[model samples]
Target: MKAMSPELASWLRGRTDDSVTVKRLHGDVSGRLFWRVFTGNGTHVLMDSGKIPVWPWIDIHELLRANGFRVPAIREIDTRRGWVLQEDLGSRRLLDVDDGQYMKLLDEASDIIVAMQRRLDGRTCADSIAGRRSFTPAFFMAELENTLETLFFRLLGVPMNELLELQREMRTLCESIDPSSVFVHRDFHSSNLMVVDGRLVMVDWQDARFGPPAYDIVSLVRDSYRDPGHVWEDRARKFTLAKGNMNMFQIARTACQRSLKATGTFSFHYRKTGDTRYLGYIPRTLRYLADYARICPQLDGLVRKTYRTLDKYHGEIDLRDFRSANIPEVRSR
Candidate 1:
């Protein structure tokens, strides 16, 4: 493995009394970097990123902490280089635990999410780095269109002409949705959460947005690493009830729309990176979409529209497996 730059190495040493040894930790989807520093006294985490530096992180840490949620403690922050030293929440996440513990941990996570939402201030999801300033109806439709065309059509092999037509239809369908927006963790999936020392902690929270609350719920339950069981769903519902005054039907509908958007996102990732992991997630996500559609006949037309597009582009992918079936091959720019 490559070594850290001399300046960074010296900086780490100075931070830890010249007793720190740095080992780089792998990053996730984003181009950030993390390092585990072993000091003579104790361990400390060092994170460096050129994008999404410390301000947003500090904002979230402060928000969750003020709301009495269980999250990592921020030790220090440097905004320019995106560096932070936070209290390590340990390695056992929801997925690493046994079935009995998993449910409880997930419940805790849901509770924390609800608490954040309940105590959220007006600017909580707008001015923060994770916040979205543009989620108006037009913006939401454009986002949906980007997912449909770049993620679904262009990446998955739907014909260009058909993609244009589908874009219009999807935009029309999306225009009908006027969801009650709230602070949303755009990527609330499992890996970003950890169960540390019998407490559930949420991490990697630099992508919060002012969008539908159900989007966060969908991000968690419909996560690729683990499926939310019936018990978990029931708990999530209870948590949702405690957080917002929205009815069950509204929550379910928001989850459905979010799931549909996610399917396109996962497909886009797979098509761009040639990684099948995201593709494996589609079935479960589709289950969310299909099940929710069954409850809301209003979405039936949109479902049919998606299927029609899929039918037209069924044979465009190159892989000879489920991952490739009806998949689009995203062209490089």
Candidate 2:
């Protein structure tokens, strides 16, 4: 079967009659398919969000655009089917840049966070989807529950009793972060940020919501995909501007939660699809947990136990999926 559907091809040609063709681009966890549509004159980025609601993407795009952010301009859209043809911002993601350039450009990205934190205040975002909900402690723990299931319990076979202590300690970590919410991109990692014409263009923002001020910085500096090299304390401090003056402790606290969350997501997706690429992130994120444990002594036991369990089951995990074959409805209330 052809990768391009007849209807989609017709839709593209219908819009750009003089177009050459469309080329597929690597997609991410989000169910959105991105395409670079080539035409006689230039190219346009086509965002196919599949059967999901496209309004959030459109709504958030306009919100960011009005806030003086560099999001793609929507040229055409089919809101019912979740299709958007927008400006092509080129393909030089910050993820693909060298360390020196990545370091320099990341400062600009960090400044973007500061600007949003300052400009996109609660009142400005009060009517938008981002304003509707904030990342509460319950939400943070719910994400960690997924990690406990996939990584600790299901995959590595850690005992339930052992995880209880970890869970209790992590609860403190969750409750420790600043409760005040700010408009955040939710996933402000390198891959979602495009470096075009000596500037940064943010994308993959459909999941934007009001989260802890440290959430976006944690996602960027301690990015699961790419390491910021050395430590992230200094970089994280630059963006930790909140009402409570949330400091390094909050940054490390947020990192522990976010890294574990990412690790769980990778494990869930890997087991469901048998994809080996997810395996690579598992160890890296675990390492981040170790690093953060030093900053927050509460995570020390959880970190050490995680390492021990992972090491004990390293061979089994490498050999096969083992006990993680079944996706259980594990919940911790």
- Specify the highest-TM-score model's number: 2
Model 1 segments more than 4 A misplaced: 1-3, 123-134, 230-233, 315-333
Which number leads on lDDT?
2
TM match of model 2 to true structure: 0.90
Local distance difference test, per candidate? Answer: 0.64, 0.79
Clashing pairs in 1: 155-328, 155-329, 155-330, 156-327, 156-328, 157-328
Instruction: List TM-score per model, in order.
Output: 0.83, 0.90
Candidate 2 lDDT tens digits, 67-139? 8998888988999888889999998999999988999988898888888888888899887888886898999
Per candidate, the number of residue pairs that clash is 6, 0
Candidate 1 residue-wise lDDT, 1-333, digit = tens: 345667667667766777567678766666667877787877777777655556776786676666676677766666676677767666676778887887767767776666666666456544455454435568666667667765556656677776677666566556655466676666777888877668777887766657766666666776656876566457656756776565555555666566667767776776676776776666556555555566567666666666555545543342223233333332344
Superposed model 2: Cα runs more than 4 Å off: 241-244, 314-333
